[model samples]
Target: MAKETLLTYLDEQIEKKLADFDVAIDWDTRNHTIEVIVRLYAENTNHMAIDDREGVRSEEEIIEFEDAILLYDDQKAVFDEDDYLAVIPFAGKKGMQQKVIDALIMYLPEILVKGQDDLLDFLVSDEESIFELHFSPDYFQALQADMTTAKQERFLPYPSY
Candidate 1:
């Protein structure tokens, strides 16, 4: 299949897995590569909104949520923006943490690509299924909203085994 066709397949497969969340995929035809971005989130079901703000939840929960977004390769593991902050505190730097976080966010797409290459190879060999989309923008958006609103609803059902 051509690159675009392959992307469609991957996107559909990812959506199936993330039916409850949002996902976005960017395909770079020039490089014959795809960048997948997913936002995993929970909602704030509390009856009252906090001073017009969304709500609140533990930062640790966010870390756990991101950690659960698994890929076939370890290199493609999901990263939590907050969890990375801990390392900076341990390093005793204030502004340094932001820099580190910025670096990770900037290169996240490339990191995912490394993991996807292996996954694509496996899927091609398997022949049982064809994966389409490489990323979920909606998922990423939800996560972004979650961070911005600081509201917590329900945990995302863990990715299937």
Candidate 2:
């Protein structure tokens, strides 16, 4: 199926680009989106008091911190012609895959850094959605602002209406 192929390709790409993180992809039927869950292996240091009579102890625990990125292909929703966020042209399977790759390359670093938080709060924060990809607008804007002319041309030269 197309979904399986996309998931497999995404997994392979993630492994190549982000070997330190573990990724799992699944279809969210209710939301009509593919949820890619990424987990980072990290150490958690905790200081705990046992009891009034007992002494305190410091414990180091290894944990996998998880966050999810959602991708949706909503062919039905209409987009304005000049919308800069409308970069992904879901014309066909191959096109979709390439666009997703571009997005992943652009955003994954920030996502990984955000995931380093203990509560994994970044996933729950409100973010802008383009082609159903949820991302922080401020972060995206900063990325755009920081890009060189060549990098901008390379990254933003997607098919436009």
Candidate 3:
């Protein structure tokens, strides 16, 4: 199957699975990856309708949690830190599309509700799984912010200055 075909299938499946949420899927040709962005609005309120000074004033706010799922061909020639997670090995393989779809259906909802850390833990524990997980700089920042402890330790060691 062609890459475009795979992308279309993924889009359709993701849309169906996450019908309640706002979803956006993009195929990154340069990186050979599909980026899925899911957004869930927790709160949406419009407190005010009109005001004299502000013309059309309104206290409208939406609290949304936007998460991403990066799916890339694991059998790529070159590898990078940013390109690890949700491995879709379509290289000389059949029935890989269904496997990918199954993985997405199982994990996407958890990622939406429990956040990225849950997936990180799962990928770390399941070494035999096709999916690979690596922490990015943004992930570390989010992890640190989510931590409740007073002391925050660095996930990766840094050199002394």
Strongest candidate by lDDT:
3
lDDT of 1 at 12: 58
TM-score of each: 0.25, 0.46, 0.46
Structural RMSD, model 2: 11.8
Give a tens-digit lDDT track for model 2, residues 1-161.
Answer: 33434545566677777776566666544433455676665444442211211233323355444456555545532434332222333322332434445456567765666546533332233341211223565665566556555533332111222
Range of the 10 consecutive residues with the lowest summed lDDT in candidate 3: 152-161
lDDT for model 2 comes to: 0.46
Better structure of 2 and 3 per lDDT: 3
lDDT of 3: 0.47
**Cα shift from native, residue 134, model 1 (Å):** 17
Model 2 weakest lDDT span, ten residues long: 47-56
Error at 24, model 3, angstroms: 1.7
Any idea how many clashes model 1 has? 24
Tens digits of lDDT, candidate 3, 33-112 = 56676665433243323232224443445433444566655654244534333343343222134444445654556556
Clashes of each: 24, 0, 0
Residue 81 of model 1 has an lDDT of: 35
